[model samples]
Target: MHLPFWLTTALLFPVLLYQGKRARKHTPRLPEAQGSPCGQYGEGTPDIRFLVLGESTAAGVGASRHEQGLASQLALQLRERTGQTIAWHTFGVNGIRMGQLNQILASMELPQADVVLLSMGVNDTTGFTPRHRFRRQLLALREMLAPRYPGPICLLSVPPMHLFTALPSPLRQIMGWRARQLNRVYEQLARHAPGDFQYRSYPAITDVSLLASDGYHPSDKGYRAIAEVLACEDWFPDQPAP
Candidate 1:
């Protein structure tokens, strides 16, 4: 999955510049995470506290309704799947990178979460972060939250950059390559982290219609698709959501 040195520097340079210019003028800004900051769903005792953390995708940019977003969808699905009332909270910003997330989590007070679902990587690629730095920041984020949310953390693969219709040409391929690299780092981290971490691969997106109008983020249908995959992961299928 590694790109050659020449391709990294020479081939991608000019394209990167062109893409940046196009993005500034053409990329549409989507709405932020909506709905109540914290929501309760289903019925059970000892409620399960769930946290949704990460960048735009986790923030629910493309989805028109808060209920259509990942946090709410996951909360509702978990109730249906396991019958536990979920105290769901979403902490996501549209354009934050991994390093910023690490810094933010380090300073903030997070809910005592039973399960933490994260969606990032896209912003890391957008920020042109080196692979090692991205990995370090990601792990740092997990470590920062470990003490407060001592439960399983599901780290989603960066959505497929190759599929972004908004981004043109070689830039798409380059971003796609970088996105894969980021996912590899996440996968490697999860392998060693075991019970504390689980790497969730980006689900295969079949319908282009599922993408938001911006074509960079997930549409409401897209978020539902993501929530479905997260809810059905074998790791948490029948267990207490934590």
Candidate 2:
């Protein structure tokens, strides 16, 4: 319900509709990364439990296996930086939106984690979810996870779609605009929540080489770059690396 999004959609509804169909028809459907969704890194009993939950990117669509995916790469990076055992788990569903995640979480018997990473926004952006609804679902998700996790809940900012090589011109432009708007909402929510919520801006992927074959999701190298940046964040200033 951001004003810009409404205005853009109103002006470009037809072009957006046509381009959306064309993009879907041309884009290849890549499978999620293979292998177990949960694993541990480094030595010693896991002192840090990390969980990644969200859409295709969280599910590791572009990578060949879980090891090469975002969650795994992040776990490896954290293990290296902290020199402590890190346990990581991911639950990613292709093309799923934030509201749908609530149902999934309610159904599953999840594990306790020390830190949570949420990868979302792409699908919501594409689906044209109203800003108010997106914010509500996000707050609800945080409420559901906070009591169980008892740690920081970091939400990764939605990628800038205008930079995506796969999407056609106007479509990419509109998507990017929407993405920026949604990210603004994320920043506001995080600002208000203080210790309860955190938002991390994504490193822009401008190079085509950083994208996967479909030109949408991140390639292994892209995931690695993202993980490196995230793992280095001062999320655990109080619990310094030992």
Q: Candidate 2 on 1-242: residue-level lDDT in tens?
A: 46766887889999999999999999999999999999999767888888899999889999889888998999999888877788999989999999998889977888768888899999999998888999999888888887687665788999988888799989999999989888888899889986767898768987777788998888999899889988778766655653
Which 10-residue window in model 1 sums to the lowest lDDT? 233-242
Clashes of each: 0, 1
Query: For each candidate, what TM-score against the reference?
Result: 0.90, 0.95
> What is candidate 1's lDDT per residue for 75-188, written digit by digit as tens?
887777777677678888889988888888787887767778888888788667888888777777767777777765788888778767678877887778778778888888
Q: Which lDDT value does model 2 have at 116?
A: 86
Residue 98 accuracy (lDDT) in model 2:
92
Best by TM-score: 2
For candidate 2, what is the total of clashing residue pairs?
Answer: 1
Indicate which candidate wins on lDDT.
Answer: 2
